[model samples]
Target: MGKFAKWLGAGVGFTLGGPIGAILGYTLGSFVDGFSIQDFTQEQEEYKQQTQQRTRVHATSGDFEISLLILASVVIKADGKVDRRELDYVRMHFVKMYGKDRANHAFKLFSGIIKRQISTRQVCMQIRQHMTHSSRLQLIHFLFGIAKADGNVSSSEEQEIHKIASYFYINDYDYTSIKAMFYNESDSAYKILEITKNVTDDEVKKAYRKMAKKYHPDRVQSVGEEHLVGAKEKFQKIQSAYEKIKDERGMS
Candidate 1:
């Protein structure tokens, strides 16, 4: 948890209150061994001071990681049983994204999290209040990735992820667009661009440009460079979708 400690102050900002705070405090305080109960989240006081100085700021990398753990727990158990593949997907992604040691700390906390009861809506409310739109979209993408890890996304898992997307205030078009990335629906390309297959070639081109900018990795740069890789994946999906649409319509 040394790296977790290093990011303690940086990651604890707006997430230190309400559900996110209570849940994290409990996980670290009661379950995680390295932390102290007296002041489990030592950065609580620091978080308050920083909040007073700013408003609705972007979530730091540490904050994003914590949020990911909470939502991941909710999604993993949504189907009534935890699939090893889904768990492995999350763990491997974290290891790939943050390396071995930090991912280990995350899994330790994640283990405790999955063992608890989470008020999904309330937890999401706290996240929506503090996290940026782009970051929230990334969360949706990650949750879908998790849901599909076991080969197919179950109905229950898709419903839970859809609820999270709604709680995050993601519009239906955007949610479908992200959802389309992992599925092979007939109009997947159109959905990825937030457009309909019936649209004219010109409208398709316009939607492509709009979505390209919207999903650009730079939109969530404040979340930190570790996330750019994931963001780039989402961005590339948009690019691929456009290419598919262009080929279908025989556009130049």
Candidate 2:
């Protein structure tokens, strides 16, 4: 290993890990990158060492970074087309949360992840499996912040955000409250669902069918699948949510 490879490895690891792991990995990478390489062989050996160490750290962060990217991509693409306002919102949040340098790097990483089609459920499952409840909640909050950054929320964006939050097992109340901060007057998808908390069998079927069609992956295909990973999750969530409502109401 070379110095660059070492730094790259550390970045990959940091992006994959939890908060503490990410901090530690970033610190180590910063320190290592400050040193000058003496020769090609030494550099290669150093790079290899760094790569191994970094990968170990990354085992935790990669999923985190990927998850964020997936959500960001979905949020940006939620309303018909992605706009500069949304991109700026993302950049601002990144810089504010991670600082300028780290934010720049994170933006690049996030953009790369969103630029392609990936599996939203897989990413959410990875987060659910690996992250603590608190961490997951915090992530959900961050996402809510992202959605609200553009002044108001779109129906598509709200549905996607709700779906993401629910995957982390956030309840109807917290999800809606967070969502409420982004929108005024109207109830969120989560809240609307809650209204039917005691819905009849027919209503449950009707709602599910409506939501499935609205959030259907097919609805977003024109924008390309890269943008619909989150939509797919929302689509599935429509089913999951409907099931919960139906089961609670004793509806088949």
Candidate 3:
């Protein structure tokens, strides 16, 4: 198989169908001919095992990159036009994840995707089917990072992100928690901890611990160094949120 074919078939030990498959088919068409659907049945069982092992070694490999690229294009175009800042932001992340050469190639693919209209719901649902909760959460975090690349997350960008999160089955609390990290509005501390003002001191501490573990960078080490960096950013927000709550409540 070719590079794009191999990468596109990396997730779930099989090729993805639906909108993701369609997007890959269209975007990768020029570089490779016929870009047909993958067949897993002909492969030896050992190859399947090796593929699964590779997935374990690199949690963000293969279709995950494709998914990120396509959905990222959607987020970049959410504001009606793509901003250079947003493109740079995504390019940096792609470079970190795949290095300079693959990032350049992927960015070219993204140029195609950015021109097309995508169904956020369809894409999110497809991702939710194959990705774990942590992976989906990281994907949302990346999207928010792109949206705020210009130093502000517009209402349109936020709305598009919210729609993606809803389709991914990410609860409002989790969604807002991630949102607070990028957009520092009032009640940000509360949002980061995924709690309300009505919560007691014990609840605040509990929420802090829960969020701390949830966003710890180590949790995503298997995914890649790029994801670890993003996770650390989220983990720091959780720590800051807890500290703010502790200072205000005098919880020694």
Candidate 4:
């Protein structure tokens, strides 16, 4: 039988908090020998419990994926229209990460749920529920990348991503850190500060100083001294942001 014939013709459905992706991924990967019925049942039970736990938390990886789809769709549609080029970028990213078959499956699943126009906050909360601090930070970083992929970050996109990040449980320090990492310039210096565009110069300096201290590797030893490496990088960014802003405004 050809590959398409093996797809069970189920039309790829989406449900809240389910193990279907794991099941499908496992099944497709095991096509040569077939999945053991017993193993499938056991895996389903495990996946169900894991899914439930994640849903109860803030955001599962699944929720993150769905939220990404939502944000992409929203961003593309923000200018009173959706560009095929932008949509293509999203689809291509999915294909690269999840493979063509699973990517298509996920896109179909997303399309069904997106029509409901679910709350973006709810999606971020779902991610925060199950993700570690580091994971949440990474999600924020990814969101910025997606925002920039199409060239500009509009007010709508910025507002949407800000709302979504709020639910992800990322604190101001971490959120700013992630934003600065992606959006800051290499030479402009303010790229590292992580201050908002609306903030006053004094506030920017204060925030940068505070964040630099908090992320100081020596101060966060409980999470592991090794993590200080990350903190150091973050602090450097903060320093850069502060310097850039001061230079631009000619502040003392």
- CA lDDT of each prediction against the hidden true structure: 0.86, 0.54, 0.76, 0.54
Q: Report the C-alpha lDDT of model 4 over 109-173, residue by residue, as the tens digit.
A: 44543344444555455445555565455445555656666776667766766766677766665
Residues 1-252 of candidate 2 have per-residue lDDT tens digits of: 254343334424323333322332333343344433233234345545666745332223334444565677877776767777778877776565445865666565555445555445555655676555544544565576566667777788788877877777877755664454344443343343444344556765776676555446565343223434444544555565656555556765
* Pairs of residues clashing in candidate 3: none
Each candidate structure's TM-score, on Cα atoms with residue i matched to residue i, is 0.92, 0.52, 0.81, 0.51
Q: Give candidate 3 regions above 4 Å deviation.
A: 1-15, 31-60
Best by lDDT: 1
- Candidate 1 lDDT for residue 129: 86
Winner on TM-score (2 vs 3): 3
lDDT of 4 at 104: 81
